[model samples]
Target: MAGYVVAAILLFSAVAYFVGRAAGERFVSANGDQVHSLPGYHGAFVAVWVGIPALILVLVWLSAQGSVIDGLVLGGLPADLVAGKTPSEINLLLSEIKNVAAGHIFSEPTPEIVAASQALLRWDEIARWAMVVVVLAMLIGTMFVARLRLAPRFRARTEVERVLSWLMIACAVSAILATLGIIVSLLAESFAFFRMVPLHEFLFGLRWEPQIAIRADQVAGQGAFGAVPVFVGTLVISCIAMAVAVPVGLYTAIYLVEYADERVRNIVKPLLEILAGVPTVVYGFFAVLTVAPAIRQAGSLMGLAISPNSALAAGLVMGVMIIPFISSLADDALRAVPRSMRDGSLAMGATRAETMLKVLLPAALPGIMGGILLALSRAIGETMIVVMAAGLIATLTINPIDSVTTVTVQIVTLLIGDTEFDSPKTLAAFALGLMLFLVTLALNVIALTIVRKYREQYE
Candidate 1:
């Protein structure tokens, strides 16, 4: 029904645009050179008026209809059915009522439930139809009013631009509010987790076991929330990945920018960027099935033991995955260097390598640093490859051949089942997330500082 309303509004909006455009054209013919806005602007103004308000109304109705219908149904039920019930119980009862309405009955429902379900369905249908009628009426009403306002003097372009500006503002505000909401949620949950487990233990302790036995009699290890190992593993793997990615990616960019001819650049750049398009899961598979085994075999040949699920395998694969980010950004940055700088250096009798090393690289350092930092963030937050290639042991070892876990892997492990939300185990995920957020934030701040410092020098 909502879809039908939206479709009708869109169809009518098109009609309104044409009608308003015709009206604007008529006004122009009647009073040539007096019309302030173009016919297209008039048409867009009419379309915005006809569609946006009605679309908003439909969205509001859809968001509110279910709750209103549920409340009405619950209110109409017998007092004994909901008398003194807690909010959770009431919610469960509402869920049952909805399930019955949807014909998902597990057993016979009581008469009150049956009657309430029927009322719920009836009210929902009525509300849906009412939404359709109201939206269509609004579309037509706005269409007529907008058409009536069309004249030689109406500033349709200004009105349309005003609406567009407001729309953009709303979108920006929504994004900011969403980010604030996420931070607040993470802070709240992390506080809950800290109440159950000490903050120092979570931040500084050396273990990462998050399992807590639900029953006192059950034999389970006392949960340890120390996150040192997870943090160390994340750092180690990211360092290894950066070690592989930065030099290779930077060199690739240099070759493409300075050495490759037009044909080679055109062919190689796209092929190199194809790495970014490959799914991470495919990389994970390559790590697990191919890279990990190869690493283990190579280790055996060297008379050293290597874990089958090793950090080295995950780090190598993740580095390959992020190569495109560094390569593409660095390529753009290197290419953005002023041609005058290169020509001046060459005119001073400097070799191409000397010119590139001394002039182009220093000039593009800020953008290259930005790309490396972005890739570092991507490496730090990666999960699938780590999970598939690096085992989830949370071992506090710097050895790339050792199996270790990262913060993202731990967060996934902590929240993987039908767990109680209020439990320390589940809340631990939020704590990890908060720490990860802070780490990434710190990285961004450091990157910005470096970029600003170099950008000033280069500019």
Candidate 2:
């Protein structure tokens, strides 16, 4: 019903736009030079009034109606059915009633439950129809009112601009609030984790076991929260990835910008960027089914021991995944340098290689560094490739052939099952997340500082 109402509102809004535009055109034909705003602005103003208010009403109504109906149904239930029930128990009962009402009954329900389900269904129908009526009335009434007010001096453009400005402000505020909310939640959960596990043990302890006995008789490892190994693994993998990606990506960008002709640039750039569009999961599969085995074989031939799931495999795949990010950004940065600089260098008898190496590289250093940092962040946060190719044992070793786990992989492992949120095991994920966020945030700040310093010098 709500969907139908929205469709009706959209159809009517389109009609209102054309009608308002025709009205504005008519006024212009009659009172030639007197109209304040263009006919398109008048149409937009009318369409905004026609759609936005009605849509907002529908949205608010739909958001609220389910809880309101549920409350009313629960209140109508017999007191004996709900007496002495805790909030969780009551919520479960309500869910059962809703399921029975929707014909998903797994067992027979009592008389009171049946009656409550009937009431729920009836109230839902009533609320949906009421919403539809109210939304339609608002749409039609606002359309008429806005059309009546459309005059030569209506200032429709000013009104439309004000609405758009407010919309943008609302979007920006919502994004900021969401980010703040995430930080606050992470801090709260991480604080809970720190209370349960000491900060020093988590930060400096050598072991990484997180298993804890949930019941007295259950067999489990003594919980260990030392995160040093996880942190080290993350650094080793990221470093390996950057080792492969930075030089290759930068060289590719240099070739594209300084040497390649238009046709070659067009073909090669797209083919290179297609790597970025490939899903990370596909890269994970490639690492596990292909790269890891090949690395193990190569290690065997060299009389070296290599884990089946090794950091080298994951790092190589991840580096390939990140090449496009560095390449594209570096390409854009190199292109953004002034053509006059290149011309002047050539006129000064400098070879193209000398001009590029001596002048263009330094000028574009900021953007290239920015891309490297971005790719580093991407490498650190990647989970699937690491999980598949890098084993989950958080070993404190830097050997690329040895298996190790990263912070992201540990966070995922800790939160994979039906775990209690209040448990240290579960809360540990939040602590890891908070750490990841801080690292990424620091990288971004550093990138911005570098960009700003170089940008000032160049400008």
Off by over 4 Å in 1: 104-111, 215-219
The residue-level lDDT of candidate 2 at 101 comes to 87
| TM-score leader | 1
| Clashing residue pairs in candidate 2 (N, C-alpha, C atoms within 3 angstroms) | none
Kindly list the per-residue Cα lDDT of model 1 for residues 1-459, writing each as its tens digit.
Answer: 777888998999999899988988988888889999988899999999999999889888889988888789988999988999999899989999999999999999998899999999999889988887788788889998998898899999999999999999999999999999999999999999999999999889998888888676868778899999999999999998999999999999999999999999999999988999999999999999999999999999999999989999999999999999899999999999999999999999999999999999999998899999999999999999999999899999999999998999999999997767888999999999999999899989988998999999988
- Runs in model 2 deviating more than 4 A are 80-86, 99-118, 215-218
- Clashes per candidate (backbone, < 3 Å): 0, 0
Candidate 2, residue 268: Cα displacement in angstroms equals: 0.6
**Model 2, 416-448: lDDT tens per residue?**
987677899999999999999999999999999
Q: At residue 341, what lDDT does model 1 achieve?
A: 99
Question: Could you tell me how far off, in angstroms, the CA of residue 61 lies in candidate 2 after the best superposition?
Answer: 2.0
The window of 10 residues in a row where model 1 has the poorest summed lDDT is 212-221
Please report how far candidate 2 places residue 208 from its true position, in Å. Answer: 2.3
